[model samples]
Target: MEYKWIALSNTTIGVLMAAINGTIIIISLPAIFRGIDINPLTSFQYLLWILMGYNIVTATLLVSFGRLSDIYGRVRLYNLGFLIFTIGSILLFLTPNTGDLGAIELISFRIVQGIGGAFLFANSAAIITDAFPAKERGKALGINQIAALAGSLIGLILGGILSVYYWRYVFLVSVPVGIFGTAWSYLKLKELGLRSKGEGIDWAGNTAFGLGLILLLIGVTYGLMPYGSSQTGWTDPYVMASMISGAALLVSFVFIERKVKYPMFRLELFKNRMFAAGNIASLLRSFAYGGLMIMIVIFLQGIWLPLHGYSYSETPFWAGVYTIPLMLGFVAMGPISGWLSDKYGSRFLATLGMVIVGIGFLLLTTLPYNFNYTEFALMLFFMGLGNGMFASPNTASIMNSVPAKYRGTASGMRSTLQNAGQTASIALFFTIVILSLESSLPTALATAVTNAGAPQLVPLVHNVPVTGALFAAFLGYDPVKALLANVPSNLIPATAIHIMEQRTWFPTAIAPAFMGALRNAFYIGGIMTFIAAIASALRGKRVIAEEKEEKEVIKNA
Candidate 1:
């Protein structure tokens, strides 16, 4: 009944919806391709766009929208986000075309949803900070962060379930939730946060920042696809130009922000130790763990599940089911960590979390492809616990360190870093995997094909594009089937064809190579997380600017 609780619940719903949409498409990509009558192998561009467009749009807009919310009202912008997200969901569910047109429509609509998500993510923490007292913000944000994690967790399972019936159901599920959140936010939420009156929009800074990030993320997205003779497009001229131009523009944005009268990004805020270190640590942690779930999913759906007798189509669902320990660990520790941070400072608790995560990553590197389920589950739970411990307190420290008037901008800056780190993390992870694969995959494939009684086809399968293989694994496709699609069956023996097509053969063959690459990724991730732990430790002490401001208000009164 209280205003604070009202604000918390509404923002939680908004975050939950946004986070759910963020991940729902990943597990359901195969079904979505089927629904639109598109072949993913030939249309890899569409797949990349569908997967990365939403996040690209969201990351690009957060700082601008957050600044807008500061100039206008956080509550007003948040309500608009809800409405737009709902509209995007509706359009996605009612997609009218098939083939390339349908895929294009889906990507465009998801961008619309990303725009809406930007608004919600940019303002939710600011709104919560506004409504709750300083002492209670950690606990409040902890619950909010839990909603985000839970939504992601639920989306995986939900996408698996919904895709079994219809791909449209994946999008349809969000419609009702979006409608409810939109109506509730518009009617019940109030403008509790301060608005920086008369501040003009810094269009120059925004344009530079937005365009810069867009180009950079686009480069990263395309860098995953095959180009010319390379397994990845990192060396493509266009990719290189885009990345160079993006970095240049971002540098220009920094200069433009410094000169502007009312800059959208308040860079000066980073001077505070808590703000700077917290954000840096947050970015590092995100970079370390962002692609972790997908990596695990690929392991499960591509190698582990299939070798264990699960069909390719069945792997997606069971993969989601098996990873339940990850969500459970986060759910168990999130609130407790928040409460602890509120009593003691974030420095110790948050740093310790990243250390634990680093340990988990190290533990994962030891796992063989045929790892025991108990060991795998325990590792997942351990990492989840570490992430849960770090997320809430780190967020709380960032929000609390800023002045009240700039909370929206601060929140936006924080979200932008976090999102950008995640995008970069995915790029980094794929690059490492693809490169590792290139060195050994050809030899492994040739050997496997020869052993499978298809020595004649070994040349064809030997130079298989690593990206396609990774995507097939990710989507739970039979890699052998896709590879042998155009090969004349008459040339190969029927017995050999049957052997190669067996669910276990391809998985078992690829497992050794894939697992080796995966271990390299884990080692890199562990090192990054340990660096994040050092950053978290360097955050010094917690500083709640609100408490200082409150005392000043009392003194004036």
Candidate 2:
């Protein structure tokens, strides 16, 4: 194989592994929690930490790792990423403790995997750009992007299959693949990009940016927790303090970057319209894409699957199966769109892609809680198609617009924004769903319990944290079972218990409130994609002549 093909194959595997880890836990969380002997409802915080921790770490470290890769070597850091990720996988599989200790160990190990992921994500695009010519960059990146995106869907399937047998197998599945990729990368890949020589690392800038983003994301994470008598922790003093401090630090980081002789971030790269607009579009698109995926999963697993006769424990696997059309759409359009963008520029195709995504979101809002599987699948396919059309061309445009020496930093910045958007999307969309649930859930639960001849249990059921219920459903736990687990049978009739435990009972009861919030969330997602389309349109055409002129100016300056 040619060296470019070798680079592409190896980097694609790295990305696929990282992306698979990103969401494999989603479907497998039920089994994982069971393995650790943790109740999904009571230990909801651990669930959030495990789900969000990887993204948070990857988002925080991308730029730093990217800058380091430029100074040292992209291939070297990328190879190390594979090794470290594999190690994390081994640790996760070998978790010795049970209960909270095991959950903590898993979270900690996931962070290690996230650090490895940052290394892979930070350099993959830059590595590919270094190997492929500018004219062919879009197609190469398109193939790479397909693997990254498809890997998430694939993880859902693998998690469903593996977790059914053993939760440890979910993590263990990555080990052999990581080992092979790590060795292949070390043996076959070489550093071909321009390296920054003799420049000192910008410690102050790195600290400001890293700490600031960490604080802000932590604040967002905790902001979802309950505080005092409130349904959410947005009013907590510590949450307020963290957000304010984080905002101030990020501002300082910007100023520091402007003054640094060897800045970790390349602020000047944004001077090009293509770079700026492409990044903005990428962030917005990520926000919509990430949030949409979570909401759709909840819809499928929490409501539709059960309504369609699938048991609660079976929902996770089938939910993944149902969403396969979405992946198919991406596979169908990604490479073709990239090739076309190489000929016609990114503006038209990318913009059209976002517009289609917005339309898909709008269509999703019209879905009944018991939506037809065919209709739901079609909407998902359109969403994937639109995202596929945008991703590769937009990435190629951003990378091609930068000077060769700055590609590492540029790639890092792009990944940082994309990962950060995904992290924030969970916080943002979940908050929306939780808040919406809080308003109606208590009343809904009270009424349902009463109607089921369990009026004596209404008070206890009503006091359940809305987030606990959401997490229970998301993790494929029967909400009725978790809510009523501790309630004494003496207070409720056996018949009532039987009625409440019916497979469709909880889903049917929660469907109205969930559908209401889900539709509203879909509307918000639609608006985001619409704005992203505008950003894509504002990117204008990528003119090679103008790009050459800008490079010449930067070179002389």
Q: On residues 1-557, what C-alpha lDDT tens digit does candidate 1 reach at each position?
A: 99999999999999999998988898999999999999897899999899889989999999999999999999999999999999999999999999989999999999999999999999999999999987788888989998998898788899999999999999999999999999999999999888899989999999999999999999999999899998999899999999999999999999999999999999999899999999999999989998898889988999999989999888888888899898888888888888898989789889999999999999999999999999999999998899889999999999999999899999999999999999889888888999999978888888888898889988797779988898898897888889888899999988889889988888888889999999999999999999999999999878999777889899999
Q: Evaluated with TM-score, which candidate comes out highest?
A: 1
TM-score of each: 0.98, 0.97
Give one digit per residue, the lDDT tens place, for model 2 in 467-552: 77777777887888778778787888989998888888888888899888887888888899999999999987784433596788
Total backbone collisions for each predicted model: 0, 0
The candidate scoring highest on lDDT is 1
lDDT value, candidate 1, whole model: 0.92
